[model samples]
Target chain A: MVFTTIVNCVRARGPDEFWRKRRIFKLAAHYIGRRRNCYTVAIKIVHRALVYATKGRQLRKQDITELRNARIIAGCEQHGLNFNDLREGLLRCNIMLNRKTLADLAAWEPYSFKALTDIAKQKTKEDGFGSVKDLQAPVGVITRGMSK
Target chain B: MSVLKRVQQWATFARIWHVYDATWQNPFQSAELLKKYLMGIHKPIYHPMNDCGDHVIVINSLDIALPGNEWAKRVYFHHTGYPGGATWTLAWELHRKDPTMILKKAVYNSMDGNLQRRYTMERLHIFPDGNVPPELMGNVSNQIRQIRPMPKRLDHYTKEEVEKFPKIIDYPKDYILR
Candidate 1:
């Protein structure tokens, strides 16, 4: 690698440039047109794509949380109980189930979810929580603090 | 697919008919609940591109309650794509003209205005009263609970139950009749 001037020799990055540009090219391999072939274009597009990929990871988590909340709300409404009351009642009962597990129970194990709603209803009745003022305590399920 | 797998697929995708009694229910709130069923969003297998929505049969739409002065204030607008062809109708007026119109409009408006909206709406069946046709009623296997409990009228309470309710305060001896 002969250089006509010292300035050109200093500017040339040598083998290190090949490996650096190759990394960006590898990342942009799936891209189309000149963006995939040219190092200059590939680096810019890859950087933008990486930004989107980073943001997408956060968005994916948010989307799953939203879906789980919707499923839980749907499950709550099915049993004539609102979401707040279910969560509050379960919390009061010391039964701490996360949204994902609760959603899974609601969708796949419906009978178990129904039992949870019953227990929740019973707890709400004992606590005299919202909307359960007129709701009768669920039969055959005596919750704690009921004998008081 | 094998017979067992085919049967499993059918069971997973089969559409269910849900019944909702709109008696004394707020139309707007009921619409939000019914929309979930109509779009099958409540199901675990729900997807925007999937055709898994269920049929919702709303009964006694004539008895829907509008909160506060909504019946007099809420207006329905219509235009006929001609000069001076706009008109507004109040909620009660529209309801009187068509008992099922308010609920139908509520459920329709609650959904997203996408290309699938029209087809999704076709799955909703609204009856002005409880006298649904036998064919439609036969398909209903689940009943969606009301958002609010029906207010019990004084006449609705049995004589013994009303009498059994404890009185809070007796009228003063010198209390004047209004």
Candidate 2:
């Protein structure tokens, strides 16, 4: 009656698990002390470091925005107009230049920036915004509103 | 432009100190000015969600003037989120306690109630007087004109300049002037 018996027991994880852990440890080889040699610690440290790398992507966006603002501010100063006035003028004239392009023109190309500012000033004047009374339209350039 | 040049351009950002004077200008107007700089609305790159603002250095805050009777009428309220914890202070009183509080509050209220507001406020630097620290002075690249012209003090006038000033009315010879 008891000639054959079958037993089921829990077994240890296979080599696949060990290899997964070994990969993380290998990537963390430069880590100092036990973090480099200990598989458990290396896994935790390397995962946390990866998290920071992910967050760094978002940080880069914020930095770019700040940089664009700086360039625009410098351009506005050069043209004797604040950022708001320039945008308002451009909007009235239906000029749809993006910030990156505007910043580029502001930094590297003064004549083009001045031309844009002149158009903006002319349009802002035509729109009846009273604050931009000081802006003088550049001679010999016809704007969108002027052609009609 | 090439992709690499465009990418390089994006990495460069300048930090500049913008000066604002509060003397004889309404707190709300000054606040609006500060808000524009704070929110980076003055820049072409300004976005509601981005922190692209420049540094705003406000001086002569003690001399800030308010339109109408707002100095006495405006009241700042606060609560501690408990029973009988509400507190109210007059604008003049608050300004007296801290000369920078009124402008700071005005600017705070003007911005949208979002997470970036606190970070924007950090860029605002308020000074009660005109004397800014030497270290901060070097960072200032441009000065924004005040909404109202600063009234010239009598001491600033030279003897020749005072003599040239037109007389409004002739005083009686017998009257002694203080």
Instruction: State the lDDT at A8 in candidate 1.
Output: 69
- Cα lDDT tens digits, model 1, B1-178, are 9999899789879999999999999999999999999998887556578798999999999999999999999999999989999999999999999999999999999998999999999999999998999999999899998999988899999999998999998789999989
**Which DockQ-derived CAPRI band holds candidate 2?**
incorrect
- Candidates, DockQ: 0.25, 0.06
> What do the candidate models score in CA lDDT, each in turn?
0.89, 0.80
Per-residue lDDT over A107-136 for candidate 2, one digit per residue giving the tens place of the 0 to 100 score: 677679889887777776677674677667
Q: Which of the CAPRI classes, incorrect, acceptable, medium or high, describes model 1?
A: acceptable
Point to the candidate with the largest DockQ: 1
Which ten contiguous residues of candidate 2 chain B have the minimum total lDDT? B7-16
Q: Per-residue CA lDDT of candidate 2, range B1-178, in tens?
A: 9998787566433556799988888888888777877676665445556556889999999998988989899899989999999999999899999999988888999888888888889999999999999788788988888888888899999999998999998899999999
lDDT at position A102, candidate 2: 88
